[model samples]
Target: MASTHSTFKNALIAILATFPSILFYISFLHHHNNEDHSLWNWCNQHPFLLANVMFFLNVNVLFWFIALLQSSLHWMIGLYWMVIPVMLLHFYANHPMAQYNQLRSWIVTILTWIWSIRMLHSYLRRENWQLGVKQDWRYIDMSHQYGKNWWWISFFAIYISQQVLQMGICLPLHVVHSVDKPLNLLDFIATVICIAGVTIAFYADTQLRIFISKNQKLKQLGQPLVPILDKGLWCYSRHPNYFGEQMWWWGLALFGWNLGHSYIFIGAVLNSMCLGYVTMLVEENMVRENYRANAYNLYQKNTSMWIPWLIKSTSNDKGKKN
Candidate 1:
């Protein structure tokens, strides 16, 4: 039984591992505050110049996309324990050479530590961990217990794997692009977008956490909170955070486009396709499963799918047709 539990924990950790790199890389790629790769003895020579070069990479939006992909995977891995550290290590090992740009790498290391610690906290505090022996069970069993309808664990794992593939696309490019050059307009824009996207995502997540936690307390008191959050940003769109997330990645992709890295283009295309599919297929299905057809149909009628805009329809017309 102990061995089985360990295996189950490892599997969960594997799924979680795919995301932390995205976070670290995104921060490393987009941060404008530092750019030198020098450390102790080795030097990038032109510290400010290298920093400025990275700043001009015009790949901020790409970083946003990567961050979203990683964080999403981390959320799923919340079911497991050991996988969290391992995931962080996986990215840490693959991190672009800090020797090439010590300043940038320093920022990356700091953010990596922060992300790892927070992810660890979230996992430890999760319901699965609190469940003791039951928490030791496999994701398959957990899904069945929740409602055998969608295989949520597998769906999450698939998305996490896709995120990993996107990260792999950058490995070769990062190696080749290691040589630094002068800054450009595109890099400046990427930096700005990266900052903006992170801010937006953080805001949306904060709002969501508050909304859910408040509702959970209300539920415990025998009052039901409406599943639909129709206040603040939620009022404008069913998925304000999703929109912010998409913007973050698309923005990063734009920055990569400026770098003229072919692999960057490849990674962007694949991630874009996956993001589209998630929005239309996986996410749509997941939402419907939880809220049921009628609620979702109504929400859809009045909410934009990816963007935050006014509702185009308010009729739950699809539900009626069905």
Candidate 2:
């Protein structure tokens, strides 16, 4: 349970976490296309059609954004954690036949809300907002943190556009989800895959946290944050954590696919593709940045980036040499 004193802090944390997301969305609609009247005009013409389309589109976009953002996870860790299960519950609730088992969907929604509540509460209590930095300094720092030398507007513009593309994946599933049928073997396999993927992600994250915390004491002594971690899961793949995460979303889509829904494939495929791209970019950049660190370079040379499949070095003569 959260302490009574933390209410204000919680509210502040919520704002900080949600602010960028909300603004990004607003800016997303504003800059994406020239016309701003799409929502209004659609609703004016046919309220029901507009509403359904909007809901469907938004949900798809949200799910895709959540998955991709989760893989990237720049600012809002709290939002990142809750977005997945909440999205799952949302898919369950807003599904067309959801009315038939509205109660079940609602149950899932409530559980998701609870999960969100717990995560948000923890973030507020634990986060060190670094409010002490000067405003200009903070802005410059954030530019480095969020924008990371990338153009801020363009980056988010691309990010939001990606969200739209990501959600587009669900259009097919939306069409098929209305069908009435018993579950099948494919469905079972998809579910298992989804569960395994998510579980692996969770495990990999847990391992990373342990790796970070192991060096926390070193950090307290005014040392820099550990530049590389090659222990535990890190030893296996430079980014087993990222690999696990990418698999999880793809797994979720597969689960949807097992339902024989094409829309679900859209959600999964786009997400996997985006993450796969980002993973390659980030890993390649890391290799260049840590070019001096022979160990890190060796790790990159030897291990797969987003795939667990180990890289076989034909150059067995190329041992770790300075």
Candidate 3:
């Protein structure tokens, strides 16, 4: 894990990660009509290559603007992700490669916009209106790991990596805008799933914020901090917010699947894998707390990590084992 963190901090090398993807995408875009290249002649091999390039290029354009906005993220931590749904809208309207399912694309865009608006509000409140001076704790931790070179390395680690994953997960939007098909009952199911995910996240974050505020008050008064949050959504899953986020991305994948681009699930799956990794880091941090460690360990034993579930007593498991 530490090595992975360092890998991202190697800005010169890490930035190369995106260079190839963008170049390949560009080569794919110009494969037929535009200029060609000898080395990139391989791009013309795939059929969806054109649409994929169109989507990728549009996303890159947005990322360029994100690049400027995120320039201060090392110190400011601004918003770049919420613009994804907007990119989908732009792509759907501008791409001339093929006629896609206009209705389906619009549906996906609207759902994403709702998610974006809610998340934007949540983030701004979390930010407390302070910009440039307040940096994200996660980025702070990483910057410490990278030491003085952090300023430069962060350009790739913080900005470039976010672009990669955000683009990956947003691939469902690309798929929806690239395919032409009739909507079905599955579309309704997908819509429900998407809404459910967003709802769960909204409530979970609300509960968590309340918990944090209460704990902060207790700390300020020289009282014991809450050892564990075992009420509401916290009773079922240790990280309902994470779970809901995965659900939201996976829900979007359903639309891609229904539209015959089932393979777009790769982006969602990879994003989940990364989230799972971060979940482990969070659990490790919880176990390190001297005051909360024991209670957190017990909670960890009974509570589901990603899936919400009823808390099963460990004594019952021990009895069954006997």
Candidate 4:
């Protein structure tokens, strides 16, 4: 059928376009290394490991593309959840440094895996995966915006772009795993910060989940939805979850910093900037559109946007005095 042929043609185009990007990324990784041994040379010596990593990337991309075709962009979240573990495992298997300090390596690997698992669990619970929910609101918004063209657009914009970002963001894992340095004072500080960030995010997400559940129950009983949460961590920062996320990366960057790998800090910088842009522009705009705009605007006036400690005077209170 003509339709079947057309679908195959689109898929082929996507695959072809993605191949060059993957190759470029591999080259980038190789060239970015400051070590004497090139990644290409290392790969040549470890052909099996190279093959496995390539297969993993290809399979992940193809899976995401298929999910896009099904109008299920939620799977992109899964791709992100898998990145840390996959990259960490790749380094563990191939890099000699991973075996240098078994305790330190285990500590890093276990912590990352725990965080990844927690994130995936939160996403699944929020999305109600058991009930077969297939997409998040952001992706749904994009689908509405793009209409018929969303299939390819989502593939490139959401899936492929995220894959690239994951590579950059997970750079710390690669560096840390491949370094023979023992855990130092900076590593301890980094660990404390990372753990604190994860704890904060965990609690913040719990509060959010509870709020959503209560709102859902109220709606079921024909009551109004609560527009804003201004208590607990929400009282300190408008986006504690996002702030925690940034802290987590910065902490990881500190680990690399302690190791004297300056370039590895790029992951934290880029991740923070990306989060800033998303939170300020995309997420806030969405909240203004979907929720009670006045309440959210008021919350924005009083609460710190990124820093939890810097609370401001509310516009409402100022107006009341006037």
Candidate 5:
């Protein structure tokens, strides 16, 4: 049947994507001891940094491969997502060759774990305890636009992009584990910021979910749905969750920044650029829904797009209130 063929294709695509990383890793392990002045020998000598980078990169590539086999991108919301951060923590605590830079590495690793776990928990709940049930709306739209090309395109556009973003944004994992900086006051600041970001994101996502569910119930009762979620975190920022996510990455970057690695900030900055695009897309999607367009525009006028601040009241908001 058609369904069977599709499943087989997805499986094939997943295998193809992951097999290269596995093969390369195996080859590296076999050749690591051959002191021939090549990158392999170099990696063997500096296994602490190189090995950690190689392992995390391979792990994330495998994630996208796993994602390819799923019915939708949602399936990537589990262990595949947590593996790098989790493994980073593990290596720091146990691996003999790891930098294990005292509380410096552990603090960043724990923050990464907390962020990943929080995201994993949120997505699991969002999917109603089941994943692979829904494709991201943008992914679906892209698939339709590209037609049959989407299969191959998905690998590059979605999977490959994820690998880049994950590795980039998680540069702290590489830096913290590779560098031997000690703990300092900056770490305390990083911890507070990281926790604050997570907490804010948690509240934002929870409030949005509640708002959505309430609207669904209203529709079920043949009542009008609430056109806007302007309460709590939403009242302060149009995309508090995005702001919080940015905070989390920048917080982790502080670990490297404190250790004199200013370039680590690039990952966080790139993440912000990507989030900016996503925010634009989400805002567009919101306004396209006729039921909420007017209310959302007014809400936009009353709030900052990313930063949480005092609500800006405009004449439109005042008139609406009257």
Candidate 6:
């Protein structure tokens, strides 16, 4: 049928569009590999590098296939989580002979895996996949906004572009894997910061989950609706979880910084910027639109957006002052 043909054509175009990003990622890997030894040149010297490249290609190809089959932007967005696992596999398979840094690499790899898995779990739960619910509100909005062109646009815009951004944001992992030095005091400090950030994020999410559950229960009981969370971590910052995420990335950057790789910090910087844009622009706007706009606006005015600091104008502070 003509419809089938059109679908096939669009799929082909999407696949073709991914090539430039693929080539760019390869070139980026080569450039970074050249910091010590050229990745492209060393591909001939070490067969493992070729295997690594192949693994990367296969994983992405699988992602593309899944995206096409599902036609769901949720899957496309979820592909970002794949970066952590792929990087971990690459680190383990291509581990250098330098035994000193092996422990450090293992630590970072494990932490990355943990963070990725936790985030994937959270996303799935929030989306409620078991009941066949799919796609978050943002993706739904995007679908409506883009109309029929959403399919191909999602391929090029969300899927491929996100992969590239994830690669860049994972620069710290690459740096950690490549560096030959042993874990030093700086690494220890960075590890502490990373642990702290993860802990904060975990607890922040837990608090939010509990709050939501309680609010839902109240609603079911026909009680008045509570539109916003203002206790626990939410009291200090409107986006405690986002702050924790930024802290975690910065901690990873600090690990690379300890290795004296200034460029690797770009990942943390980019991650922070992305979070800021999403939290301040996308998420806040959505909250105002969907929830109590005046209350959210007041919260935004009083609370730090991305840092856990006292909001002096909060009810508790006002009560104490009075």
The C-alpha stretches of model 5 lying farther than 4 A from their native spots are: 1-74, 77-79, 88-97, 314-322
- Cα lDDT tens digits for candidate 5, 135-228: 5777788888998877678766775676567667777666676668668799899889999999999889999889888998999999987787
Instruction: Count clashing residue pairs in model 6.
Output: 0
lDDT of 3 by residue, 1-322 (tens): 6544533443333234245545654455555454456434444443345435543453344344444465534532135366545544554444445457778767787888888887877766665533333566777788779988876677677656765677678777767766788999988898988998899888888898888889989999999887877778887898998888888889998988887776888888988998898899888988898988877888877788878998776443221110
Put down candidate 4 lDDT per residue, 1-322, tens digits, no spaces: 6555644554454345346435644664556454665764576455335544654466456656556565554444443444445544554444432433455556666667767776766776786533123455567788889999887777676756665566666666666655677777787888888888888888888898998899899989998777777667877887888888778878877766777788877767777877887786754674565555766766766678877864565334422110
Model 6 vs. true fold: TM = 0.75
- Best of the two (3, 6) by TM-score: 6
lDDT of 6 by residue, 1-322 (tens): 6555644554464355445545644564546446465554455344334434543464455555555676653443453463444544454335432233778877887777777776766655664433123455666778889998887676666655555566666667667765678778988888888887877888788888887888789889999666677788888888888888878888888887888888877867877877777775655564555545666767777778878987767364321210
Number of the top candidate by TM-score?
5
lDDT per prediction? 0.46, 0.47, 0.68, 0.64, 0.71, 0.64
Q: State the displacement of the C-alpha of residue 68, model 5, in Å, after optimal TM-score superposition.
A: 5.4
lDDT for 124 in candidate 1 is 49
Runs of candidate 3 with Cα error greater than 4 angstroms are 1-72, 75-78, 314-322
User: What is the overall TM-score of model 1 with all chains considered together?
Assistant: 0.52
**Over 4 Å off, model 6:** 1-61, 76-100, 129-132, 286-291, 316-322
lDDT of 1 by residue, 106-197 (tens): 33334334434444544444433432223323333444566644234444443345345435433322422353444467655755664555
Structural RMSD, model 1? 11.9
Residue 194, candidate 5: C-alpha displacement in angstroms: 0.7
Candidate 3 vs candidate 4: the TM-score winner is 4
- Report the candidate with higher TM-score, 1 versus 3: 3
User: TM-score for all predictions?
Assistant: 0.52, 0.57, 0.74, 0.75, 0.80, 0.75
Candidate 2 per-residue lDDT over residues 1-322, each given as its tens digit: 2343444553465345444434534453444343565644433444224334443444334433543443322333223444534543444334333322333223323433653554444333334333111222222444566664434442344435544553444332333233344555654564555455555555566666665676687678876555565545665576776666555556455544544565566666676686676676666655665522555577677766666654544343333321
